[model samples]
Target chain A: MYAFNYHKPATVAEAATLAGKHADGKLLAGGMTLLPTMKQRLASPSDIIDLSKLGDLRGIEVKDGVVTIKALTRHVTVANSAEVKKAIPALAELAGMIGDPAVRNRGTIGGSVANNDPAADYPAACLALGATIHTNKRSIPADDFFVGLFETALGEGEIITSISFPVPDKANYQKFRNPASRYAIVGVFVAKKGADVSVAVTGAGDSGVFRQKDFEAALKSNFSAAALDGKSQSAAGLNSDIHADAEYRAHLIGVMAKRAVAAAK
Target chain B: MPTVSMTVNGKPVTGEVDSRTLLVQFLRETLRMTGTHVGCDTSQCGCCVVHIDGDAVKSCTTLALSCEGAKVTTIEGLANGDQLHPMQEAFRENHGLQCGFCTPGMIMTAVELVGRKGHNLDEKTIREELEGNLCRCTGYHNIVKAIAAGAQAMGAKA
Candidate 1:
């Protein structure tokens, strides 16, 4: 990795200021993605503003039926949090299924969502559970937060503070993971709140994560794994890689969605 | 250059290193604690696993500067002089290693796993937790057995 200035700001204001000061400054959370990317020479930031010192950005809180997770909270914390498990076990399960126990120990939800890796697990949870991405500047709905692959609605120097997920009546996330990398080959998160239902697909989208309207509609009528019977996901615009072809991914989407629905509590 | 001070294996050590230096490099080169191996630098292989602040992490991917003032425990720290840690002893008794290249990391990860899950670990759970630690040798049969035995020994020893 290239040597650059490193600053551990204790406050969000200081972090934002430091980020705005340097043109190529990057905010360092867990450095799970950023460090490896930098090591591979895929990214070269002029400065690294470490947010690990920001104590306020590391926690989990549930209030008014919504679970709010601080951006810097590690995946292990989320996976083991009783509050998260009670409020949204699917989110906890998703967190637990990330890279591995070691990676979960270091990787942060904020880093995962901010990086917006097409195959990342958190994006599916965010979109399916109707999460609200709260930045230092404003709040953006999950639907609008993710723009494209490796992209988000975050503006320059806009730091994500926390993500607020509404506790769904029933929700579950299932993934067909790539054995080697543990990345989602095809992940589906299904959530139903009263009459409203949302189905989000990740790792199989050409434009990154997206809501499956037809599946959501099907679940809205009958919330069950069998509801997806004979329902098909179009292969158009889905991701095709060495791991899985677009058509196969489209098939896995149906399989995972049904599993997610069956597994939802 | 960054000056990082930390407690390694109960010894307070300090070093001046490049900001880009990985924790494994600091341990293997500066401190000469080579037990923490770097099998695959890409963070996929668990040969560089060590306990930072009591959590097992990949030292190859973790920045040395980030571990300032943290407590680090490598495979070398697992034993008390001639007395082997229960996990290490279990590995030996069970013939858990073949090449011995992945033993340090495997032991480190297993030690932490036992700490978190305790000695009553099922085979599936043990296998799942051992995902990070890879071994080209042993086919993981004896390693899994060693972890279960180690966890029991740890419980009995405690």
Candidate 2:
């Protein structure tokens, strides 16, 4: 790993100030992805603004039909939180499915959302549940937050403070994970609230996680597994790799969506 | 270089290290505590699992500077002097290891698993919990049995 200056700030303001001071600085949330990238020399930042010491950016709250999780809240914390489980059990289940126990202990939701890995599970939840990402600067809806693979709408020097997810009436997530990395080869998250429904697909999109409008429309009418019968997801823009071809991922997306719809409560 | 101080194995230790220094490197190099091994430095392998503030984490992927004032427990800290930890004893009794390269990490992960999941761990749960710790020798059958027996032993002690 390349040598860099590490700053552990006690406040979000201080962390942002440190971030602005360095042109090539990276915010260290739970260093699950950043540290590994640095170790491989793939990302060599001049400064690492460690956010672990920012006490205010660590919590989980449920209020007014929304579940608010702070930036530094670890995956394990989200997975095990009584409030999260009671409010949004599918969100908790998705958090628990990420990587393994040790990885979950250190990987934070904010970091995962910020990194916006195409195969990550959080993006699907964010998009499907219509989450609002609150940064130190402003709030951005999940639809506008994720721009592309490994990218977000976060500007330089801006820090994510918390993410607010509106609790859906019913939601579920199903994924066909890669055996080695455990990343989703094709994951689907289905959410329905009142008459509105949303379907988000991750790990299969060429541009990144995307909303499956067709599936949403189908479920909006009949909110059932059988509602998606005879519907097919096209492989036109899906990701194809050694693990799975685009056609295979397209097929898995439909299958997983059916399963998610069937399992959602 | 920056100075980092943390409590490891119940002993306070301080060392001057580069900001890029990994916690596993600090333990195995600066402090000369070599019990924690680094199999795959990329965080895929759990050869460097350790407890930080009573939670299991991959030390190789964790920065040393991030652990300031934190309590860290490595594989070397598991046993009480000459007496082995229940997990270690169980591994030995069950012959859970073959190459022994992944034993330190496996034991560390197993101990943390017991702390969280408790003693009544079933076979499926044991296998599922051992996802991060990979045994190259494919000695998982005995490893699963050892973790179950070790969890029960730890429960008896408690």
**lDDT (CA) for every model shown?**
0.93, 0.94
- DockQ score, prediction 2: 0.89
Candidate 2 lDDT over B88-153, as tens digits, reads 999999999998989999999999999999998999999888889888995599999999999999
- The native-contact fractions of the candidates, in order shown, are 0.61, 0.85
Candidate 1 lDDT, tens digit per residue, A34-150? 888999999989898888788899999999999999999999999999999999999999999999889999999999999999999999999999999999999999999999999
> How many angstroms is residue A114 displaced in model 2 relative to the true structure, after the best TM-score fit?
0.5
Isolated chain A TM-score, each model: 0.98, 0.98
- Residue-level error in angstroms, candidate 1, position B96: 0.6
Give DockQ for candidates 1 onward, in order. 0.76, 0.89
Per-residue lDDT over A142-183 for candidate 2, one digit per residue giving the tens place of the 0 to 100 score:
999999989999998899999999999999999899978889
Residue B8 error for model 2, in Å? 0.4
Local error of candidate 2 at residue B156 (angstroms)? 1.0
